[model samples]
Target: MDLNVKITVLGAGAIGSLWAVALKQQQHDVQVWTRSSDSEYSVNYQDLNGNTHPLLFTANSVEHLSQSDLLLVTVKSFQVEVALAPIIKLIPNSCLIVIMHNGIGSHEAVKALFSNHCVFYATTSQAALKADAKLQHTGNGQTFIGSLFSANSSYNVLTEVFNQALSPCYWQDDIMEPLWKKLAINCAINPLTAIYQCTNGELANKNYQAQLIQVCNEVTLVMRAEGYRVKNDELYQQALTVINATADNYSSMNRDVFYQRPTEIDYITGYLIHRAKKFDIAVPVNTQLWQTIISMESSYHA
Candidate 1:
């Protein structure tokens, strides 16, 4: 299929760079927007066979991004608003905005802010990190996408673009389920790993297994009370499976804590705690994890 779409990736972080490089390789017109006024963003592509190649692309400013046919947002949750504010006027109302973020509430937040455009939520297990201006693709995983409502013709174009450029796009009637499911996994593993300074494998030890279950339980309760059909047992099993599969991998939150960068705990566990209060559901475990991450941030600054 011939891809005539002009794609712009905001943030130019690990995931953003990964998508930009992948799309560019597929023969699409791809550009990346970065906060860094630097002339170029470096990206390294690594396949499943362990081969790597480095490439550099020019970084465009927000005002120049308005002409893109599609915009993939990969900014940290906290930076979303600030990063897009100056460029909001540049985004065409007809352009599709795909937010491939890791936490809950991003879709709603983006939808509220960009009411005129089509906002879609996407989730992927593809692991990546930035190093020396290049994005390192660490692990391979599939991506799921769906509209906030039912399927539209636009989604057909999106699925085609994703399948050709990124691959393994699962279309769903309701994307919220997978969004919250991924959020449950993040709430269970990210904070614990960040706080304990351990990899996913370390959670398998007896000392951390029970705490892991508790975190999953807290997220499950909040999700269920919020009208999502997530069970504690199922979420716990999913967390365990992820821990075993990515045993040596350090989560993004873990990397943030290690680098003294701000973590996305507020959008992950903290979002659960905030919603639990609205539903009169108790989420002490998640609340504690939220507090712990906040304390870590305080200490990092201190």
Candidate 2:
């Protein structure tokens, strides 16, 4: 059965804009919630063949938040708390909140509040690049949906919405595998890109290959510690696959650093460092990566 739902996407970055437009195209009532008022709520949808289509949508402030059947939290990993603080209160427990962003811990932050609203975690390779006033859809990637803790009544409706309207998506009984795997790749790619000031594929250069491998190895060990099936070599190769696939794109961290904004280093590399400490495992490489990124942030922000 097809279910009609009102969805509010709470973020106006590249990915948020992409999902907002994509879901709206599917005939769902989708509204966007950004931090402030922006008249430049436009996006260029570039199809696989390089065809571009302009999409404009309704954008509202946090104060204007009305009831929606679902809320898609698409802010940066670190911005989740502030972004949803006021808006979450406006949302009812009956509303389902789905978080789609890079890295981890956002869901846990919400779970810490002990809210009764259904919460789910999502990861997507869907690539969108933000320009002056409009975001460009650079790539079409699949969206992966997973439960934050347990699947709830909204799972079927959310799954059906994506499966029927949005891009290719799946519901996982245990999303930790794919989530961790994606995390492994992000830890290897995003921070390094920020430090090196290069595109994803630049890491493929022989000079940076060792650093990439070390990061991969450290992440794999942590993933294994958490009981996920992970092989360092296999993850290394998989990371390469992601790099080749999105070779020209700058990582979110790279953008954050370049723009002198706060990066999600704490959630990505910082989270990995915390996990390593739990197992009393030495992740000197991850530690150094985290410190390097943090130091760069301080110097740049200062």
Candidate 3:
């Protein structure tokens, strides 16, 4: 399709590095921006099958951002605003912006901040983690994208570029359903796994089955109140399916809490709790999990 554009990845973390390498392999002009003043120009990428390759990126310069046609943001949900505030003016107004992160809420903030640009939301199941200068592709999953603010933008170019770089990228007319579903899965599995220091599979055990169902029920109530047609049973079953699918791997929240790093519990469960309060809905279970994670985060330094 001869798709070539100047793409700038706003974060050099695991997810950011994964896509940076994938897009560069597709021959796009890819550069990365990191929080550190001293960062590498290349990333050591390890594919899903454990094949390691040295991938190079363009110079991380302010001028490159001005010429960027697309900005793919892969930062944590909480750091979205802080990371983009500095470089937001450097990027062209006409550039297509895609914020692909774990949880919700960041899309609204970005849409409001970048009012002139077409902001899109992407939810991906593809997992990766960073170790020093190396990025490991832990799992392969599809990507779903849809427009959050601008509905008239050209998605064909984005679909082709993303699909070729990372296969199975689907364009959805209503991306919120899939995004909420992903959040449902995260809400049900992530906190329990983190608290218990267990893998995803352990959530399927009898000991945790009731707790999992309660979490899903609370999330389903909030979802329906927020205008989504989600059922409690269906959400519970979906969580079970995910628990079986990624049985061995620990969730991102689990890893974050284990490493004493800040987790995105705020965006995942916190977003739901906020909506629940808006509708006068009771989400006690979700609230407890959110508070527990917040408590855990507080004890990170103690």
Instruction: Identify the leading candidate in terms of lDDT.
Output: 3
Please, what are the lDDT tens digits per residue for candidate 2 over residues 170-218? 8876766677777888899998999889999898899999998998998
Query: Where is model 1 poorest over a 10-residue stretch in terms of lDDT?
Result: 148-157
Winner of 1 and 3 under TM-score: 3
Candidate 1: residue 120 Cα off by (Å): 0.9
List of clashing residue pairs for candidate 1: none
* Candidate closer to the true structure by TM-score (higher is better), 2 or 3: 3
Quote each prediction's TM-score: 0.94, 0.93, 0.95
Ranking by lDDT: 3, 1, 2
CA RMSD of all predictions: 1.9, 2.1, 1.7
What's the number of clashes in each of the models?
0, 0, 0
Q: Rank the candidates by TM-score, best first.
A: 3, 1, 2
Which stretches of candidate 1 lie above 4 Å from their native place?
61-64, 149-153
lDDT of 3 by residue, 55-147 (tens): 877656888889899999998999999999988889898788989888788876787789888788889888787888888988888898888
How much does candidate 1 score in TM-score? 0.94
| TM-score (C-alpha, index-matched) for candidate 3 | 0.95
lDDT of 1 at 37: 79
Tens-place lDDT digits, model 1, residues 59-123: 77554476788988889887887777778889998788888887876655576788888778788
